[model samples]
Target: NSSVSCHIVQVFSNSDEALINKKLPKELLLRIFSFLDVVTLCRCAQVSKAWNVLALDGSNWQKIDLFNFQTDIEGRVVENISKRCGGFLRQLSLRGCLSVADASMKTFAQNCRNIEHLNLNGCTKITDSTCISLSKFCSKLRQLDLTSCVSITNHALKALSEGCRMLENLNLSWCDQITSDGIEALSRGCTSLRALFLRGCTQLDDAALKHLQKHCPELMTINMQSCTMLYPSCSKSQMTALWFVCLAAATSQITHTHTESFIHIACVFLRILEAARCSHVTDAGFTVLARNCHDLEKMDLEECILVTDNTLVQLSIHCPRLQALSLSHCELITDDGIRHLSSSVCGQERLQVVELDNCPLITDITLEHLKSCQHLERIELYDCQQVTRAGIKRIRGLIFNFIGCCVILGVNCVLFC
Candidate 1:
């Protein structure tokens, strides 16, 4: 025991000398510490007094992703990180950090004024006040992910609109309290906004979208899934399922809607659009989208029950860049829809992902159509009862998918399988 203690002291003495004596420059040591993750940096801090200063230095704290420590992370940790990181903190993800609250975030906004990207996704404890702090201080903020932050309301969007003008991407998914007022304010101030995700903001009507189309010309990606009252029919007093102007009732031909608000949003050259579960969306809505958003690369129409082969025809004819398309649960999508999509220039060249889940009508003929899709990488056929095992095995490289990569296939089979 005595010999072991003596060896430990000698090792510490050598380590101290090695650290103090100019064996490695301080700048180089800090640079090396910069490469270390949060957990490793914290461990290195306990190594020695010199190591602690290097590990905790503001320059080394520019980017931090605390998703791994979501459950353990508290407001105090954020406060300390803010104090240490200061304006040097550029990007920090507090996603799923459930315990982080407003007070610590206020301190963070004040201290880390230069922060450009901050993710508070699932941090539901904080209210609009935290955003007020950000609006006052963190004006340089660009991207913010507030997914499932149910407490956030119109006030926070108002604050952000007034202060954070440079904001490009924002995810307000499941923030049900946000109304058209907040969206209008956001559209007016943050015209530079590119991508806006408002999944499940059920209250916003067409008037809210009119504001976005009016101002945000640079907008590319927009997701307004499950906003039940999105496309309000003037004839009917009640709200409707078409939000994000996402869909309309199926028509034999592609016809434009008379709704002024939904028509205007077509000006946005969006690349990625996910309007899943807007069940009422039909050919008219898809036509408007396909005609306007020629740049649309990916679209999710899952559970859009009213959608038919006509929507597919419009997409293939217009959206030449169409790569990924989801028609899952749209039972109206017959083999002809797949045939039209796969035969076109967009289908053969650009089409990569096609999800036909739960569409009972599609037979082996649908698989035959998809064979021409040279770039087709993934096809979600889960619960597609008509498609048999023989049909799946007939496709080239789909066997490889069963072995590795993307989703597996089968009707009445496990999702991952």
Candidate 2:
């Protein structure tokens, strides 16, 4: 009986040794596993209780991209992580996490106000109420992406501008309901605004830009691309001087048009221009850009219907070192413009990246000419019906896979097998 008891004890001792002694130190294990991609790292969580804790810790969580782990099940998991992480989060990305409602957003905003980067793209359930709450709670907002948050109105922006004055980078893109009034308010309030993307905010017009020029002087980058209403071409030459003054006066009679005109005339300087969807902007407005902003790099003349090939033919002649140009949706641009671009001063080399999205006029003939460009890295041809598959056959393909199926297609912006 004593011998039988000794044998059982020996078996148990061996089992404990095999289970615990060979286990790796948690710190060492996490250090080794942190290099793995999100998928492989997530698998580590299922290994044991120790691993699950390590994987969800702030150190490892910082690198794990939330954009990839986007499923109905993962929403609750991420929220739980937010609650567990306390205040250690530096960058929080909840992009495309549809289940994260206003309450979850408020919880995050209130807790993670110290976040250096926050991406709330496609979080449709988030309304102006969330923004109002964030204004009071999140004062350290630097980089914010409110893209596709359709419910955000002027009230939300007003709240943010009044409170989050430290905001340097803001993307209000695709918030179509936003008007020039909201933009004017932001321009006046967020004086430190560096980069503001007003893309697809159709209600923003010339009045907004005029306001920005007056108030947001420190603005380095502005993306008004596809802002169809603000198309400078739509505004009459007379409105360039009259509309802004009239609107400002109507609001508060701050300064009369004639008085502002005299001041502008004394110091003739019109620096920034982004007349992408403005079908009315003729060579006249472009001539103003060519004269001023000698250091101007970005020019988006896409879908400016009045801007014929002749306009570009002149712009290339004047703006020699133009770096980024997007001539998307400009159906009128022909080989004449492309040929001029191929040989002119602002030709391939001086130009770094150019977007020819939906410009049917550009074929392989133009693309082949563009291949001569040295620094050109990205070329967006999303809906360009004319570009055949042969155009980008040589470029290496990257797949944005979601679990098993790909959602964003690929470089060409079309369905891929």
Please name the candidate that would achieve the greatest lDDT relative to the true structure: 1
Compared with the true structure, what per-residue lDDT tens digits does model 2 show for residues 1-417? 999988766644553343432576667766776677667767866656666666666666553357775565244565676676646666777788777677776776676666667787887877888787668877877778889999889988899888788888888888989998898777777877767887778788667767666676566566665665542222212212211111111111112232233223211222334544555456655555455434445666666665557767766777777777778777777756777765766665576666777777766566556555555545666666666666544322322211122112236464321
How many clashing residue pairs, candidate 1? 2
Residue pairs with clashing backbones, model 2: 231-278, 233-280, 233-281
Error of 2 at 324 (Å): 6.8
Single out the weakest 10-residue window by summed lDDT for candidate 2: 242-251
What TM-score, to 2 decimals, does candidate 2 have?
0.64
Candidate 1, 240: how far from true, in Å? Answer: 26
* Candidate 1 TM-score, C-alpha based: 0.82
TM-score of each: 0.82, 0.64
lDDT value for candidate 2?
Answer: 0.62
Q: After superposition, how far is residue 37 of candidate 2 from its true place, in Å?
A: 4.5
Per-candidate clashes, comma-separated: 2, 3
